[model samples]
Target: MRILVIGGSFGGLTVAFSLRQKLGARHEIVLVSKEARFTFIPSLPWVAMGWRRMADISFDLAPVLSRWKVGFVEAAVIRIDPAKKQVHTAVETLDYDYLVIATGHRSANEAVPGLGPFDGPGHSLMSPPEAEEAREAWTAFLDSPGPMVIGCAPGASCIGPAYEFAFEVHHALARRGLRHKVPIVFVTPEPHLGHFGVGGFGKARQFLEGEFEARDIRYRTSAAIASISAEAVQLVDGPSLPSRYSMILPALSGVRAVAESGLGNPKGFIPVDAHYRHKDHPAIYAVGVAVALPPVEETPVPVNFPKTSNMTRQMAAVAAHNLAADILGGAPVTRTLSAECILDMGDRGAHMFADPIRPPRNRSEMSIGRRWLWAKRAYERYCLWRLKRGWAGPASGLLG
Candidate 1:
């Protein structure tokens, strides 16, 4: 049997390694990706602040996968023909008995007018290029300090980075004795701080509210941005916040290839069952951000569920187990994912843990300190080292 994985990030690599270990040398596995390198996305905020570089967080994919005896195809995927059981790529078309879609997300910068670093006055930290662009903007802003705005646009699922960026900016400015000059404002679509698109964890809302207040960082909740301009950010039914520099996380949509192939929903994300198998295509599986998950609760402004790295790891493991069962003869696998995150806050960090991503959980923990920051940094190095070596050990309880 042959399996094709269409991505090269956390989801794709974990699925490939897990399958190889389970099936041994009896089956074939191939990975197709547009990028030749795998970047540790959690470190992009540090890159934007000049605390880290791209080389420190990324590594070439071919050599790493080659060491593990997996085939690598560096090409952009054009479409997947489920009926024909083939994938068309820029380089060539390949046939497969099973397929895995983990193409990640596409930043929907066009959702708001004038919201993109390359095309407009706004900036983001989703990609390497965008992070580097943000770095350049940060350097320039330091020379001429002014009021700044940082937040997430409507429909944005990933809110941790925006918080991290806000704290990092404050810390960096304070270190340079310029914090008093820069008035920082945080805006979010969530009904309140620490909702995290998954109901607030124990004391998370209180903790965040207190932290922001103590830091003197003003914030707007349940706010919708109408548009962004060079001099200010306009809000819907609210006052315009003047901002000389801005970084806003835009909404995300599935890649065009998946949407055109009729494999994803109207928003281009795949719908999967308990085992991470596609509802329509039994032979196909999806993990990570490619899978569609509804918000835990409704908010005044729209917010989607966050598909974090820890959640992706669990989904990949479950998908691999179920795929193995289809060929190796066993019962299917089911799993309930927990929320685990180490949020970087410049010099300090916060560790948030919930038994499940949704509410009414048996366990919820939240703590903040300098030690958590050290742990976050240490985990980044350890994770990259392990991944580069292709060690597909256990996939549970990873603090991402």
Candidate 2:
């Protein structure tokens, strides 16, 4: 059997790498990706703040794929024809017996005008180049400090970064003795912090509320920002939020590549069963942000769907095991996803972990923290180090 996995980020690579070790040379596995490199994206904020450079977060993908004896194709997937079981690319069409889509999220930049390039985009840290842009923006902001906002818009799945940036900015400015000169505000669609991109983490509501107050960081939760200009963000509900410059994390939707493939749902995300198989097509599976997550619990606002790296890996593991099972003729195993992460505050941070996501019965949320900031740093280094070396299993070092 031939297995083809698309997208080369954490989820896709996890699927490919796991299959390589488990299946050996029994089946052909091919990975299709446009870029030649894999970036440790969670570290992009450090790059943006000039704490790390772009090169440090990125490593060549060709070497790892070759080392594992997996086929690598450097081409953008233009379309996925599930009916034909083939992928259309800019270069050539690749046929597959099984397909795993890990295309992540298609950043909805234009969902808000001026966010991507209202005339010109101010800055972003979603990708490597965006991180560098943010670095330059931070430099200019430091030179002329002013009231600033780090906004997370409605429908935004990756909401943690905005809070991280806001907190880090506060710490950065304080180190320079210019914190009083700069007003740092946190704007988010979640009603509370630690809501993370996943509903609220345990005690995150109380913990973040206290932190924001103590840190003197102005916060506006449940905000649905409509648009942004060079000077301010126009809110959907009321008046424009004023600022000298804004770094807003716009909402995330599925990538157009998957959406146009006719395999995606109305939200451009694929629907997968508990085993990670596509609902209508069992031969296909999906992981990461490209798979739609139902709301954990309904709120007055829109659904708060969580998509963390830990959850993505669990989904990939199930998909890989099932794919291997089909080739080996055995029962497939399914696994439930949990949440884990270390949020950096620069000066100090927190470490939190949870299980079963939406746990059953009376079990409460699991969490613990007390300036385990050093632990967060160690976690980040270990994750990047393991993935680059393909030593990702057993550790499963999730750095969401």
Candidate 3:
């Protein structure tokens, strides 16, 4: 049997490595990705603040996959044909008995006019290159301090990074004795602070609010960014804020290749069942931001639901288990959609665990302290080490 995984990030790598362990040498497994290296995305904020370098968070994917005896293809997938069971890349077309679509998300910077690294004056930490650009921008900002605005664009799902970058920026500026000179303003589309794209997590709202207050980081909620200018950011609600430096998180959309495949939703996210199998195509599965998930509830300003790294890893595990069940004979597993995150605030951090992801959950835990900051740093190293060794690190269950 042949299984193909299209992506080399958290979800894709987890699925590929887990399946290889389960199926052993009996089946063929291939992992395809556009990039040659895998980057630890959570550390991008630190990269932006110059606390971490790209090399510190990224490693070549070919060597790791080679050690696992899995074939690696470094090419952009142009299309996927569920009916034909084929994946077409820029250079080749490969057929597979089972397919996992973990292609992740593309930054929908065009959603808001003049918002993005390429077309706008603002910076983003979504990708490794973007993080490097942000680091350069940060260094330049320190040379001439001024008012700054940081927040997520409307429909942004990955909101944690925005908060992390904001606090980290505050911490960096304060350490350099430029905090008073450069006033920091946070703006978000969420109705309130700490909504985090899934309503609000336990006491997270209060905790974040208190932290922002203590840091003197003023914020504006229900803020829809209309456009970004080199000199300032304009809101749809008739407010214009002066900001010499702006870092706005762009909304996520489906990769163009996935969208054109005719297997994705309007927003380009693949619709999947509880088992992470595609709703229309049984042999195809999806995880991470590539899968479509509705918001817990609607708000005045649109907010796409978040898909954290932990939750994505959980989805990958479930999909891998179900695929093994189909081929090796076992009970299929279902995803729990659990989330575990450690939000770094430069010197301090907040750790949150939400089972089922929505409110009124069975388990919801949150805590903040300096120890968590160190814990988060350690987790980065541990995660990279585990992934490089082709192990499926804990996503859920007791260890998670």
Tell me each candidate's TM-score.
0.98, 0.94, 0.98
**What lDDT score goes with residue 235 in model 3?**
94
Tens digits of per-residue lDDT for model 2, 170-219: 88998999999887778787766667655666778898888889989878
For model 2, the superposed segments whose C-alpha errors exceed 4 Å read 117-122, 359-371, 395-400
Q: Give each model's whole-structure lDDT.
A: 0.91, 0.78, 0.90
**What digit string (tens of lDDT, one per residue) describes model 3 on residues 1-400?**
9999999999999999888888889999999999999999999998988888989999999999999889999999999988899999989999999999999999999888878688778889889888899899889889998999999999888999999988898888888888999888899999999889978778989989999999999999989999998889999976899999899999998899899988889999999998999999999989988999998888988888999888889898888888888999988778567788999898899998887788779887789899999999999999999998988876523222
Off by over 4 Å in 3: 396-400
> What RMSD does each model have against the real structure?
1.8, 2.7, 1.5
Best by lDDT: 1
Worst 10 residues of 1 by lDDT: 391-400
Task: Show pairs that collide, candidate 3.
Answer: none
Please identify model 1 stretches exceeding 4 Å from their true place. 396-400
Task: Judge candidate 1 at residue 242 and give its lDDT.
Answer: 98
TM-score of 1: 0.98
